[model samples]
Target chain A: MSNNPIGNVWIYIEQDGGAIAPVSLELVCKARELARELKVRTEGVVLGSEIPESLIATLHAYGCDHVFVADDAALKLFSPVPYQKVIVGLAEAHRPNIFLFGATVVGRSLAPRVASRLQAGLTADCTALRIDEFEDKASKRVLKNKLMQIRPAFGGNIIATIVNSWQDPQMVTVREGVMALAEPEEGRKGTVTPVPVALAPEDTAVTIVERFKQPSEVNLKGAQIIVSGGYGVGSKENFRLVYELAETLGAAVGASRAAVDAGWIDHDHQVGQTGVTVRPRCYIACGISGSVQHRAGMSESAKIIAINSDANAPIFSIADYGIVGDLNVVLPKMIRAYRARV
Target chain B: MSLSILVFAKQVPDTANITGQAMKEDGTVNRAALPAIFNPEDLNALELALELRERYGGKVAVCTMGPPAAANILRRALYMGADETILLTDRRFAGADTLATSYALACAARKYGSCDLILCGRQAIDGDTAQVGPQLAEKLDLPQITYVESVEWVRKGRIRAKAQIDGGYEIIEAPTPILLTVLASSNAPRPVGAKRLMQYKKAVTRSELSARHGGRDYEDANLLAAEEEGLRARGLWIYEWGVDDLEADARHFGLAGSPTKVKQIESVVLTGSGTKDVPPTDEGIRDLVHELIEDHILS
Candidate 1:
């Protein structure tokens, strides 16, 4: 171990259009757990322009010991090249044993680049993490610095345990909702470490000509309730029932990869190994025969309700509640009852 | 000017679905039980390289880092119009992760002298680790364009490519002698040509033929005679390369050089049960919806 003491476990807070992504705070909770086990502090790494001071404190309430702000004009939008260079430089200068990033589009692109530059081992889309302890008899030393990074491998059929044996800092990207959220605290206080990054014109290889945010139709990752459709919904038109129920309950509409491939829904709303992994309070699946790929994404949902015509649908296996019925008929009545209740 | 494109491919065990008593008692994959095939995406990458070679008029070299069994893919590469093939097979290259594999491949690539372009699949299905291409670029000090959805232009010195981004795609320009990790959307690999398959059917590697004979007992005279007759008959002959041929760093070639290790494997079986059949009636729907809302499944 280097004489320079490791300061704090930092969580790179992610935000899109001024709203904090739920995964950012989810990472804070996970980092908090890790810090407790290691007897270290937890910090939040936030980068952007015009971020409110109040938002910095919000991170503290979520268990951040210090909020490191790297506000800059170039970071106003998400771009891999500049973001990676800055984070990698910071990580190299101030080494952190374990860096956690959300397994979003941006994180996936940036993590690998940073990992390559730092020559660190990075496990992607990890579902779990823990610290292990061991003693080296020959050296008369206690080897207590092992971070076991766990993620689903072989198309989600097997869970692989990956370790960064050489590098001082081990990195892993976690999918949203894999860990529980911490209770919010009031009047939390933490120091803010302001770091300055200089951006050059040549630093960014690809440029975004325009930024378009389509009228956000229910961000499924942040949705408290979700109504998802699957292949068993049968036809594209049958998806109307899923949307109707979602509309009635004010829930976001999600779909299995099969439905997305069938073009019944867009890829953004897909929930599976290749799609978004959601951990909403409630997730209702209509006509989805759950495969390991699909389950890998949403099996962690707080409450799962599967509605399938088949009695032996795999979705029923993990569902908190199972409804054996044709989704076409079951969805309509559920929508009506939800409307009536409201 | 003709383009010489080099494509890197791997033969991975088909891990699409694991079942039966195929998995070993130690929880490791039983390679013998699993059918090995040319990785689908790598085939796609090879197809793209072949298409470029055809359009621009140049030679194609296909290479792989595996055991002698990997010669199957090299022969198929020849059937697909690759001018030459190289197999970087050595007992030292076993159980390599993406990092160590890239190191060995980069060494072999350097020995291939200089090439105009190199192409590889974004990731292998078995490992699903998309690190080799980028890591190779780092080692070779070449410009890398990953997630390449399509190639707009491949000129003499510069190449224009489009990479898939989150919302859409970004078109970027990089100088030649660059590396690209082809996406699945690039193009479908063409089936083997009947003529080429028939012509190269007898092609064998030195190791393969030696193994067939239980040793290298066949006299050099007999082998030379067979090669001459086979070439005259169907243009078929073996291509061989020893470790010294590539001049790779012996220490950095395989498992011993690899830093990553698989500690344990666990099979997580997810099981649950729920409501299965609902009547197609108004009241039946009402009850279902009520339960969903009460359970916060709909709200």
Candidate 2:
């Protein structure tokens, strides 16, 4: 019914080592648009050991009006308690209208603690964020420009729109790659202010012993074409057909959540609501009976091809081309045919 | 020294294997059509707790907050060798978001007294929010370690565990009275122990006992008390508490405590476009490949 008293739209500028996480910049672009609608300024908060001038500059180029830096050696490592304390302290002092965080492993872990401390509402893994005029039908009152948080409801192909209409400092964690990356305007500037992170001995409870960073082999998001398989593709051995077709086309491979749950493939290549969401140029679905959750991730693909034995499979309904046949028979033929053309 | 480990669990709808009946034509979910299950990851948490108790000569107690029916998961926990179980239930606790849900849990946990450690699944699959465990830690002012894969050891008032990061794993250690949200990859959950299952099969909470007695019409309080007395004497009585038992602030019980509210729910409606079907023939396969190449879809 009432709005938060006074605040600007704020984004948590997440950092790994020295570079700013891409999602933080993405939020900056979105926050700029949102703040413009609300007629407020956009601010960002960065916590790390040594604040980088380039990081602050990059955020400004994307549209942050002001940046708050909490630099301390304790803040260097990503420990839950200390990180939570810094964000909570900053949020309490500023009282932001809306706060955002990346739905990365760190964000998912930290957002809740801060939200709880601030008694703020938090939505996780939001696919869509919007500002809308909400009407409380029961009260017969219209609340203007409430943050509409949208995510997929589990158990079915349903979308739920949640609102933190009753709370101050509405918070939401957005997954990476969900928003378009903003282009930088080199030399763009913003005001930088320092926020002190004072941590108690209790704050640093969990000690990190070591870290071994390994490069991820799968890059489904960057791929132009994806040859994806599903449970209908049958056993792990039969998946060789799908892999062969992908190799022939020089395309990356993906799998449905069901395929990953069945232990036929790893989690990184799984594409759907619970996994990675990809919208490649050409998406070839082999024996994949697409559910609404699966389609939510890839329905925006420029071209779609569906191959399934069941003619009535839901995937065919959205496919640019449909082939009612066995994947085992269809994949080898596709490979052979494409080879002939090459 | 023995360890007192408390495990928090939840009974959630099995959302993974949704059948056609799970959805209504109106696009909203028909929740009754789906089966209620012990949230998978919580089982992993309980398994870890059971193992710790076995190794350290302590007790493993599992707690859950939900409707009266949620006692089902607590019983399931007992079947897996949990020494004790708690069900915190009340109509006032309905419609709680993760924050409010964690509040009720922390209150019930406080009533249950302190333990050396707290364990729970990273998150429930129903919402996949992964908020409750850490939020509960905040409410209790305890330290937390999430995404834990394995516990290396617990000795001299400290627990060492391995937790997963985005690309790698980290070994972390924390003092007693800490919380760890376990991951399913940590260890395979042991199946129900036949001896324990048969032993705890008769266990039921006060609400469940009332149901079995055919509401209040068939029996009076005297008969109910007698039945409960029998259950308690034989260690088959499950602990039950509601909002009043925990002395919770009325504001923090449910919707009033929740900062978030569901504004809208819509079914994903996909409008099919023109679909061209290709014959699975030798000639058709070659022609299709040629068309893709012609369109420059293939480099």
Candidate 3:
């Protein structure tokens, strides 16, 4: 262990084009909970090219006790080698009890390298996190302060809770929208520690050739309300009803894997075990039977409403409100009412 | 130059329609009842491997670490056009999490001799951890690109790939001797070719031969040995390697080395305020919409 005592729960602040990603803020919020349970400080580690003070302030607002900044020209773009070098450096110098990363492309690639180099145990794509005590089955020896990493297993058929009791800086990469973001405390104050990042020539072996952001790619994570359809929607052309409901509600359109597999929608719009997990405030399911796989993704929503032809559809079991009817007949009337109200 | 590509695959329990019997009492999946299928994404990885082999002359070898029953996927891989198949099976290799699993795979990869590339699915549907591919790369000390969507080009010992990012896509270039974890949407996997299926349908692993011939001792199974040798000579045999064959440290073989402990597993059921039924009529729809607006469900 380093001479500096380890305690802080660190969040790797992910940013792109100099703007912080929402997932980073969400992780900071999560780290605050872990820190409170462990009685430790919550720190945000930001590595980029001249990160703004406003970004540092945002970290504080989101519950970070301190912000570690390693701003350099070499760190401008997200490269695996250089980012890992700097992160591993920080982890080595000031050992942290827990390191939380948003399971984005950058985090997923970098966490394993850091964990491997450190020989630390990491659980990826966790949906829930908590502090729990672990006991050996045979000897009954107990270990304290274990991070209980809860995630879906066997394609969302079950939830497996994993614990890495041995490794220091217990690492976890959480799904982007699984954790709810904490409200920011504006004017919140925190310390900023500037760290040195020296990049070696060999650290740039893998380079980015080009990056293209397609506006057409669907992102259901940030949607306040989601209007999702399943095979019950009937046909690809009938998918219009789902979209129309979403339009009236000013929400994103999501589809179950069955709809996508049936070629009723693009893969980008899929929400389920093989697709993206979403945690919108309100989710309206139209003609979905709610398979366990589909529920794995959207069960976290604050409220769910199901509309289906069958009253016994599984979606209705989890729904706060159920409408037993053909969505084509019911959605048109709902859309008309919403239009009148607006 | 024929590029040697190694593909890591797994046979997973079909979790599409789960029952109470899907999981056993020990917080482990009950594999006996669940039908095992070639992990869907691994098929995409295999497809990428085959496509690369076709474009730039190379040999593709598919490997999986599972029970003897997993040889089914090896046969499937062969049917799909893999030049070779290796089964890394051993009783001691059971109950491995990502860490130990990757260690055993890395050991087998080293014993397989020189490899220019390694490919795997982004994550197995069963484990859903997505750590093995990257952890395997780290254990092998190779550069890796995960979430790969396309292999653009490979020339002069360097490779370029298009991969999905947070918002869009990124083109990444890395040197050879790298590992890539392909995404599910990367490519449409090809079906089994009739000719390749006929040629590889007789392929069997040594353990399979031992089991079929009703002899635990390898030396006593004379007919099985001869038939295996005949298939081996004809290049229709799947390579079988145990822990001893790979010279893997006993400590790192399976559950002993895994740091993760599954504390509990629960079948999640979402509970809401009991659902209220709304009629199919227009007035019912209108009242429901008004109620939703009043309850702050819809704005």
Candidate 4:
């Protein structure tokens, strides 16, 4: 509980091979919205073996007031210890009021360790965040300008709004694609502070034996059309119909949590809050009874079509066209009809 | 090289099977209606730890922090060939968030003495936070590898494993005294052997045995010691530890140490106005396809 905050909201900028992740910018934009409410500046902290000049420029364009950077060969790949050292060191000295991270693989691994080192409170996979006043009736007082972190909890339709009133530098890792990515201001400017990286042999114990990048895999976000299946898809053999339809439509295949849990398909295709958040141009859901968490991911698609045997499935609520029939009978009709029309 | 490994497990409400009765009028989960099961990913973690013990000839102990009923997972661990089991149960450790949960777990873990490695699932299904394993590593001051797919080996004071990254994967090498969070896709966990199950069915924690004694505990110290001795002599005693056993500060144990508080639980209301219900027919399918084509959604 330190009252000596630097009056700035800081975001940890994640980069891979000199390219900044889009979630970093989304958080910066969100931080700007939060910072304005608190009357503070939004800044960024980037650590890479090589920080590109364009990456810094992009941060300023996205509304960061300052960018703190530490570049070194030992810090090239993302490791828990070295990354924690850099972020925790900067946080200890600057003492920002709020810190944010992207809910990516790198962000999830690093944020918890940093929070533990600082003894700060951290909320993971936050879908919505805001600044509000808290009425602590038990203590007979009101705490003003607290960060309200909202996320889905206990895996039902339950949504929990969390607050970190007991800890300073309230932290969260924002979900990808949840916040809107604002258009960059192009030529905006900000100040940059270069931090020196001091490392010992103990800090560099882990070495990257190999890194394999697969760019041609299942990319749900970039797809224009998606053919998704759910638990009702039944056996792994029945899932072949979904792949066949996706092939006919030339679209990527998606899955509900049930299909993935049943081991019918790879988890990369899961479309929901726990998985990937996607907004394709057209999303065709088959045998999927959409939960609130599932809807939170793909409800924003340009158009949605749901096919379920149960007429009362929640997926139909947001679907543009709802088919109350078996997908086994309907998916083939959809594929054949589309082929005949083309 | 024999290694000492501790695997962290949790019993979570089966979120996949949420029924209408599971939700209350205020939108909070009616937790009692949901069935609790061993967390799926933690089984993967246990499998990994067991695999290590098979190769390295070390001890694998399973620990879980929850209600007295969480002892169920510890017994299951024994059935799956775990050498030891510990149930960290205390009434004061209720309503703990991830940070306080990790703090109590770290204190409980030290009771097993220093171990070469620690393992747990990437995240629990109930919260999906994935914060405890790494937070525990930070508390223990050990390097951690998260989202691990496979452990190549843990020999000669160093560990090598392949961890899943964003797009693909990366292989890294780290020193001993490390922690790894296992993913679900790692391997198939072995089932409980019938022989082990038949033998260890009598294994009971202090709370469980007391419940069987008409909910009465041994008030005499010698009687309690003799009871424990009889169970241990028959290889049926499961270790149980409370807050005092860990020497944890009262303020840092449960809800007191939790920094984050749930402010509110928002109710969900469906609000889609223009959902067109299509009939199941050939014309209905063809018409929908034509509309999508005309809208430039399809080629």
Which pairs of residues collide in candidate 4? none
- In candidate 2 the C-alpha lDDT for residue B97 amounts to 93
State residue A140's C-alpha deviation in candidate 3, in Å. 3.6
Which residue runs does candidate 4 get wrong by more than 4 Å?
A1-6, B20-28, B219-221, B271-273, B297-299
- Whichever of 1 and 4 has more TM-score, that candidate is 4
lDDT by residue for model 3 (A182-301), tens:
899999999999988887776777888898875555769878899999988999999999999998899999999778867799877877654678988899999888876688789888
Give interface RMSD, per candidate.
4.4, 1.7, 3.1, 1.9
Across residues B155-260, which tens digit of lDDT does each residue of candidate 2 receive? 8989899998776788888888899999978889999889988998899998889888777742468988988999989878789989888967978878878878
**Candidate 2, residue B44: lDDT:** 95
Residue by residue across A1-342, what tens digits does model 4's lDDT show?
124343589999999889888789999999999888887888899999878899999999999988999999888888889999888999988888899999888999999999888888899888789998887654667888899999877776677899886757899998777788888899999899998888778877878899997753888878999999999888889999999999999999999988998999987888887777888999999999988777877889999999999887879889999999988899899889999988
Per-residue lDDT of model 4, residues B73-165, tens digit only: 888888988888888889888888888999998998887789999999999988888999999998888899999999998888999999999
Q: List the residue pairs that clash in candidate 3.
A: none
Cα lDDT tens digits for candidate 3, B12-119: 888655566776665345767888999989999999999999988989999999999899999999999999999999889998877789889999899997788899
TM-score to native of every candidate shown: 0.80, 0.95, 0.91, 0.96
By TM-score, is 3 or 4 better?
4
- Candidate 2 falls in which docking quality class? medium
Kindly give the stretch of ten consecutive residues in candidate 2 chain A with the minimal lDDT sum.
Answer: A1-10
Of all true interface contacts, what fraction is found in model 4? Answer: 0.84
Off by over 4 Å in 2: A1-5, A137-140, B217-220
lDDT of 1 by residue, A163-276 (tens): 666555677777666667879787888788787888766565444543434443548888888899988898899998898878877789999977876678887888876677
Candidate 4 chain B: 10-residue stretch with minimal lDDT: B215-224
